[model samples]
Structure formats: C-alpha cells, structure tokens
Target: MTDDAPRNSGTELQTDWFDTIRINTPAVERRAASLPSRRSLKKEWQAAWLLNAVRCMDLTTLSGDDTEDRVARLCAKARQPIAPDLLDAMGVSGLTTGAVCVYPTMVAAAKRALRGTDIPVASVATGFPAGLMPLNLRLAEIEYARDQGADEIDIVITRAHVLQADWPALYDELRAMRQACGPARMKAILATGDLKSLENVARASHVAMQAGADWIKTSTGKEGVNATLTVSLVMCRAIRDHHDRTGIAVGFKPAGGLKTAKDAIAWQVLMREELGRDWLRPARFRIGASSLLGDLERQISHHVTGRYAAAHRLTMA
Candidate 1:
C-alpha cells in the first residue's frame, strides 16, 4: 500500500500564505515539563504502549562506520524487533518497526535484507544533516537513493533558507526533491533544533507540507540538540493545522535523542493528545532512534518476567 505517498502532489506553493501560528514559549515549556508526571502507565498497559512504540519506530543506523553487514543485521532486527518468545508471550503478533532508516548507500543492503517484509527502507538523502551542497547534487542524491530501492526519502532542508526567511527558496528546493523521489515518500527534516525558534519550527513545517512532504521530521539526529517535546508539540500543532486546512494527513517523525520506554510513551502521549488517537499509528507517527529498540526490549522483558534485564542482554543490532 502507498499510504505514505506524498499527500499534497500538484498543490501549488503558497509562500506568503500560512496561518498565524504564534507560540508562547513559557506555556509550551511548562506543558512539556508537566508531561512526565501527568501521564504514566504500568505493567500490561506500559508493555502495550512500548509495543506500539516499537511498531511505530523508524529503526535507524546512520553512522559513518555503517557497513552492508551492519545494515543486514539492522534489517534482520527490523524483521523481528523483539524476541519471538517474548512477542508471543506478550500476545503481540506480526510486530515490526515502521521502517528501517539508513544512509543512501545502504538502501540496497537494507532492501535486500528486508525482502518479503512490509517494512520500508528509508534513506536519508539530499545532503543530509548539513544540506549545504548544491541543489543539483542534493536532488541527484534523492534520485540515486530511489533508484537503489529506498521506499522513503528523508531529505534535510536548507537551514539557511529558514535562517534567512527565504520561504520561496525552501519551497522550490523541497518541491524539486519531491519530484525526484517519484513514488517514494519524502520526509522534510526541519532540523527543529537548528531552526532556533518555535515560530521558525511552525513556519518550516508549513512550508515543507506546502512543498509536498509526506512527513515533516524534527531532526537529522546529528544536531547537538535533537528532538524535544517542545519542538515536537510545535511541529505537530503545525501538522494539525495543515491537516485541518488540506484534509491531508502528513506523518510526523521525532528523530534523535529519543531513548528508553518512558521516552517512547511520552512521545506516544504527545501524539495521542495533540493529534488524536489516529496519529498514534505507524502511518501517522514515527520515532527515529538506533538504541531505542534495545531499551524498549529491556523494558518489555521486565514487564513479562517481572525482573529487569541488564541492558547487555538486549541486542540492538
């Protein structure tokens, strides 16, 4: 199914048009700070939430030392993210991550390793992280990754455009990248940590959606400051606003720095509370992390056996 296909194809770019999204910093921070204590789940409920978190994770490995063998192992882990016995005992069937994310060069390895499975191979394309390369080179990277069987393209936006308030340039760049992606879903990484302000985050979210991004992701996971609940709230609210106007649901991915079962549940609650229960699914929300699965597996083991397993016992691959 192409449920993740670009939601706003053929939509004209409206650079000057966006809802007035004023963000109250103190209020947003307070709300984010209150989240940990306000929401808590235990035992069966906590395990169930963690399983849902796993199902919605974009299992990722974007390190410099990532090799085909490493990607193969990552893909294998994606195929069976949790221990089979534990999964069976927990009564969770057919569990898998939302996708397997890797560098563009690793797409083929991941694709081959994950064959016959529904898990999409997501590639970080378009001069990822920095996005300082020329437009042609960036666009070509998207095409190359697509040619190599990337089901989803995670393209980093030119942060300079946001910094300079060059909305039109940003819009044009993303539109071309979307066209290059062909049928593969395109996720515009705003790198919210770099955007600086909540207003910038909201605006970038709008511009990316206007340019036909299937998803508006928060970070490249390389920034000193990665995904935060405050940024996520801003971006998700932007998504909610866009959906209300366009009747198109764009997926949200909060990548970087998200670890532990508690972190996953916190994000789940944010999605559920901000965008409703529908956004809690893999189709609408994804958490990107490399080590998050290990922590989640350990938590699940604790839930099932009533004893916490050492972190070393879990295999993140």
Candidate 2:
C-alpha cells in the first residue's frame, strides 16, 4: 500500500472491544504449529512465494555500530536484492526489497542512498528496544526522524501500560505519537515479549490500532523473545477484529529472530491463511530482519541452479 491510502482514523477508547477476550494458549499453539505442516510449496511455486517474501521484507540494519557506509551498502542491496542472473533465471525483473530500515541518525544517509527509488526509509524511534523514556522525548524523537526524511517511523510503546492494563494511557500515548508522525506513517511496536500474555497482546493490538497506528509490529528484536508464530497469531486476530469493527485495514509486521528461508515462508503462510492475500504485500506485511536475506538468497539459488550456493557467494544484507 502507498502512503496515499486512507489511514486508520482510529475510534474512541472502547474498553468493551477487548475487555473480556481470553486466549486459549493450547489451541493457539496447536494452530500455529499446524500451519507449516499443512501448507507445502515446491519448485516454481516455492520460488514465487520466496520472491514475494523478498518484496515484503523490511531489509534492516540497526546495530550500535551502524554507519553511513553500512546504510549505503544496505540501500544498494535493497535496490537490487537478488542477483540479476538469479532474477533473470526466474523470469523476474525490477525486484527489490520492501524497504530499508535504519536507526534515526542513519535516515538521512539511507534517504540519500535510495534517492531515486520508491523504497521507503524506516527509522526506529521512541526509545527503541525499550520505550522507557519520557513521553515528550519519545514524541520529539518521532518528529526528529520525520524531519530527517524517514518515510515511516517505527515507535516503541510503553509496556507498562499494557502490563498494568492501562488501556487509556496506552491509547493516549499512541495517539500523540501518531500525531507526531505527521506524514510519516507510524508503526506501533508492541514488543509482545514484554507484554507477558496472549490476552495482553490482543488488547494492546486493539488499542494501538484504535490509536491510529498504520501497522502493529511484533517486537524490537532486542527482547528475550521477539516475533513468534503464537504471538503473531494473536496480533493478526486483533488486526482482523479491528478491521471487522472499523472497516479499516491495519498492517502487521513480524520482526526479530526470523533468520531462515523457512521462517520467511512460514510467516507468509500465516498471513495468507489468516488475513488473505491483501496482507501479503509490503504495504501491509513486513518481515524485519538483518540476516534473513542471506538464507533467502541461498534457497532461491538452490531452486534456480539445483545446488545451494555457499553463504559467501550471496551478497550480505
């Protein structure tokens, strides 16, 4: 989806929307486990799915040592994610990763590097990995990134609000962040790992969407746990529920710990099975990872050449 699409205007803080919701842990686990086993793709079909995953990926680099050079190289990779020969072998042309994600300070470098392309530069703001900073500082951070030319701002939400079941507080904070985002789309990172329960995940998802989050993300990729199929399932259901009530579509992003080709396919399967084909696009779905492209290249190469390429043979992400 483009930035021009109608955004979720959000609704009043309706506690009854998710107040009595209770998740069945065993059932959710069973369903998540069954997905990979049930759907099996092969040969050309598998190749196509993997390519779609590439189109939906948020190719990222968010290290403490990240630099302009690193972000530039990452932008280059985003522009041509797959090798020309490999993509040509598959009869594909003009393929690129969904976006290039970087830290706030790296936004300008990324924007400059990706100057001619439609690819967006996403920045992690609002005390990423830990939304423990004061609210004013977080809002200012969002504005700073926006001013630096970030197309999307991924903001971390305060886990305390969800942990304490303070729905109003969460809603208010996210609303302010949304306003701060201005033209830059706001993605609310729930950090589901810290929320503790599936019920909390569901509730927080509702509040975030109700607070005008364009997308609800799974994690910061710095928690003890990040995106898991189970947690993602809860978030997807909440997204579906929000759509059901408001006639608005909110995006879903699964970040952290997604490192393999299999991980890419499984999450796509989840999105397809749960939210339909619309959610499979980059505008709606994004897989946030730093090393996933390497394995994806390996697998796609294996499909194209009938032999897997060594790790070093592929361009690094």
Top-scoring candidate (lDDT): 2
Q: Model 1: runs farther than 4 Å from truth?
A: 1-6, 15-19
Candidate 2 C-alpha lDDT tens digits along 253-315: 999989998999999999999999989888899999869998898899999999989878899
RMSD of 1: 1.6
Q: What is the C-alpha RMSD of each candidate to the true structure, in Å?
A: 1.6, 0.9
As for candidate 1, its clashing pairs are none
Candidate 1 residue 142 C-alpha distance from true site, Å: 0.3
Count of backbone clashes, every candidate in sequence = 0, 1
- Residues 89-184, model 1: lDDT tens digits: 988789999999999999999989998988999999988889999999999999999999999999999998998989889889989999999988
lDDT of each: 0.88, 0.93
TM-score of each: 0.96, 0.98
Worst ten-residue run, lDDT, model 1? 1-10
